[model samples]
Target: MSKAITNNQSVDLISDFKEITKMRLAVSVVFSSVAGYFLGAEVIDFVELLLLAVGGYMMVGASNAFNQVIEKDLDVLMDRTKNRPIPSGRMSVKKALFIAFTFTILGLLVLYIINPVTAMFGAISIFLYVSIYTPLKTKTPLSVFVGAFPGAIPFMLGWVAATNDFSIESGTLFMIQFFWQFPHFWALGWWLYNDYKRGGFFMLPTGKRDRGTAIQIILYTIWTIAVSLIPVFGVTGRLYLTPVSGILILILGLGMLYYAYKLYKNRDEISAKKLMFASVSYITLLQIIYVLDKYIRIWI
Candidate 1:
């Protein structure tokens, strides 16, 4: 009986840890960084790639843990976040803080070993997410804007990790992801506006689910599509989109814009949800296209 009880306790601990770190979201962040690393690397080093993945996950996890700690009180008021480890009392603040600190130090150290520039960007991402963005969520709608800085860094950080340089190539990658976030997050804000209000968060740009918010989503969707096509122009070094991939990217962008337009026209949760899913598909497909195009260009 005691052995069985111990096993159950171990399972509970693991589950709590996953909840605290938001493992799925961390993995997605690592995927973007890995895609950037692949684009930047002239010769792939598997070991460095492994380190990048681990460090990226650690940094993202730490940021999430810190956000939970800081927002525990507010989190309890929101249905979506009320069950998180901290807010639900599944974990203590001191334990969560310890995990956050450990992950932060280890993550930065690992990235530093890869390259100083990568480590510096990783540190900045954590600072911006935890210190600036987390607190600003309740203060102003601009929190999404501030959050985008760190949110967009992973894609570019991978490039810096591989090249140890910040050039037009990395800048273009950053800009692409940066604009993508506006529509992606606004769609989410639209869908979760009521829940957010319950938690005292002003995440939407207009502070309400209105025409102003939908118009902004459409405008940013346009900007996201426009910036995504820039690589095909041959300006961003080491990142190029061939004609085939360019056309496909345009189609993907249009798909997202179509959904955004639907949301604008309908101004309903269903439309917002569709736009949210469309935004996710747009970014995933766009990145895959970029990476495939890079390799194809190299082989030919």
Candidate 2:
């Protein structure tokens, strides 16, 4: 009976590790970093690429872990977040806190091996995400803007990791993603407004599902699409979008805008959900298109 109890405890410990680190989310962020690296690196080093992947995962995982730890109290208030390991009592706050520290330190150390600048940015991302974004969520809706800073950094961080410097090129990547976040997050806020309200999180800029919030979403969606096309017009260096790819991207962007408009016009739960789904598809597909364009240029 004692042996059975001990084995169960061991399994539970392992499960808690996965929950705190959010391994699945870490993997997704790592994939985006690698994709950005491949798009930016002039000379690909498999070893460096592997390091970037692992270090990026650690940094993102640490941020997510700390976020859960800090939001443990509020997590219990939202239906969407209520079942998370911390709030569900499956993981103790102490254990989650310890895991957060371990992941953050290990993640920063790994990135430091890549380059100090890359590591510095990684630390900044985690800091802003947890230290600023988490608490600000309840205070103001501008938390989304603050969150976008760190969220956009991952894509540009890969370029800095490869080049060991920040340049207009990296800045352009950051701008494109930075603008993309507003519409994406606002759409999510619209769909989850009730859940967020229950948790005392004001995610929408206007703090209501009104014309103001919808207008902001549409405006940002336009800006996101415009920034993405800047390369095609020769505004940014060494970045060119083929006419074909640019057209396809524009179509996708317009689709996103249409959904945003729908939300504004209808102001219903169903419309908001559609916009949320469209925003996700737009981001993932945009990254893919950018990567494919890079490879196609090599072949051409």
Candidate 3:
């Protein structure tokens, strides 16, 4: 091959790798793990935290790669996903499978270095996302409900990695994220209903962007907000939340709820998009608050 053509091919390969892995989303998911680690660790071990982040990203990336492979054909029908590596013919199924397996193994090994339980959760996450959730997408809208299990694991996985135990604290973390995803994803689903329909994805709970879906989104947003504040209660044990932090989280949740309410009233794509962004901001800020609260409480 000519030198110029070879360089172009290399660039394409790099781009394809990013697309298959959904790099940005993977990093965001890993951030949730880092937040969980902060809550679990008594004395911060930077090395363990680094390992958790890397391993978490790898597992998430592997799941995305496998998802793209399984949905290659359906992906091509949707504008949002038609340009992905496999759907666009930029990557082969064989190569993508190789990457997925490699990531799964390496990710599990890294998590195992932390603790056996952590590694087990990592394995479970991949299995759910790839084997169960991915297949259920076209078949039922309940796929999101199932997918939330793997989605919720990263935050709890971090806590499990640090403590080497699954406690009510970790379960609280899982429940918070689990409830949070409904409004978040349904908002995105509302905005992209047409696109998802083209891909045969059952995203909406009621399978339509009607009042039923909007009302559920509002209800779930409320539930997500409630779950996030559970740490303030004594039931969560070590995962304590001060009144000030609780107030802050409440405000953030209210903001997200406001957006959801808007979507309900407007029942338009624009409103849905706004709610989706708001939900993302709420969860991310919620993590930041939890981490900062933990450290601040320690210092003071």
Top candidate on TM-score is 1
Candidate 2 lDDT for residue 85: 88
Deviating ranges (above 4 Å) for candidate 3: 1-5
For all candidates, the clash counts are 0, 0, 0
lDDT for each residue of candidate 2 in 202-258, tens digit (9 for 90 to 100): 899999999999999999999999988877776667556788888989999999999
- Candidate 1 on 52-138: residue-level lDDT in tens? 999999999999999999999999999999999888988999999999999999999999999999999999999999999999999
TM-scores for every predicted model:
0.98, 0.94, 0.98
> How high a TM-score does candidate 3 get?
0.98
How many residue-pair clashes does candidate 2 contain?
A: 0
lDDT (C-alpha, whole model) for all candidates? 0.94, 0.86, 0.93
The residue pairs in collision within model 1 are none
RMSD of each: 0.8, 2.0, 1.2
> Model 1: what TM-score?
0.98
- Models ranked on lDDT: 1, 3, 2
Candidates sorted by TM-score, descending order? 1, 3, 2
Model 1, runs deviating above 4 Å: none
